[model samples]
Target: MNNPKFEIFKAKNGEFYFRFKAGNGKIIIISEGYVGKPSCVNGIDSVKRNAPNDNRYERTDKTDDYRFNLKAENGQVIARSSEGYTTKVNRENAIDVVKKEAPNAPTEDQTV
Candidate 1:
């Protein structure tokens, strides 16, 4: 869909997931899991514009040389994995992070 609120993607293991901003700069997960590609695609909006919004998550917040270590509001380290890794394990890590933040999302329902 073209909705800016959320996007569904298939993980490398052929599992699917719904992801979106939790309004408070958080990310929420709506689906259990469905692996599609070998990994997750960067947000299309940020990619097409060549200006990856700071609000949206990106592999390299600083530059290509460095990767991101996804962190939660309470200082809990979520997914230290980067988008550069397209392995199933990496995709799973991303999902785990999304799930952790999803429950506390202000704009989305907690899947529990």
Candidate 2:
């Protein structure tokens, strides 16, 4: 299995954001932009801590697809699945995989 990683970067608008990548370098999730780098880092930490918990995920349906938001303990959305899943089971399994991968994922600062 490929070891996943989190890549942090600065957006064109100068906000900080991050994406979680699978070992194959495929992005699995993308976070919302933060005004500061520290806030972005905290979002990453929140995802790592909360992804493993089923209760922390808020499932939603968009059109015909399903997606989920990983939320912090405070109920703030930290990160979201990159692509909509075709089935609820697939969406839930994707969350389970994120829970397994995120804790051990290394960080790569691409903000330069």
Candidate 3:
């Protein structure tokens, strides 16, 4: 079975970001771009620390889809859903998966 992991990569803009992928290889959560890789890694650490808290999730429903943001205790948005879900159930499921996977997910340094 594929293991859920955090992949850190550098964007073309020279910023770094990290994405949490589920065991199925679907990206569930992605951090905002950081100017440095260390900051991006810290973002991933924050996600692992905050993901299990239900209150940290800020859910939204747009006209066509549902989305969510994972926030740190300081109220900073650590990560956001990779894509809007077509249904509320799907969005919740994605959040649940992140909560379950993030804490133990190993980091894959793709920034090399």
TM-score of each: 0.25, 0.90, 0.97
* lDDT, candidate 1, 1-112, per-residue tens: 2222444555566564555553344443333443442222222222222212223333443323334443433443333332344454454455444444433333222222
Candidates ranked, most accurate by lDDT first: 3, 2, 1
lDDT of 3 by residue, 1-112 (tens): 6899999998899999999999999999988999988888889999999999999999999876999999999998999999999999999999999989899999999867
- Top-lDDT candidate index: 3
Clashes of each: 9, 0, 0
Stretches of candidate 3 above 4 Å error? Answer: none
Candidate 2 TM-score, C-alpha based? 0.90
RMSD of each: 13.1, 1.5, 0.8
Off by over 4 Å in 1: 1-19, 22-85, 108-112
Tell me the deviation in Å of residue 65 in model 3.
0.7
Local accuracy by lDDT, each model: 0.38, 0.88, 0.94
Off by over 4 Å in 2: none
| Clashing pairs in model 2, backbone N/Cα/C closer than 3 A | none
Number of clashes found in candidate 1: 9
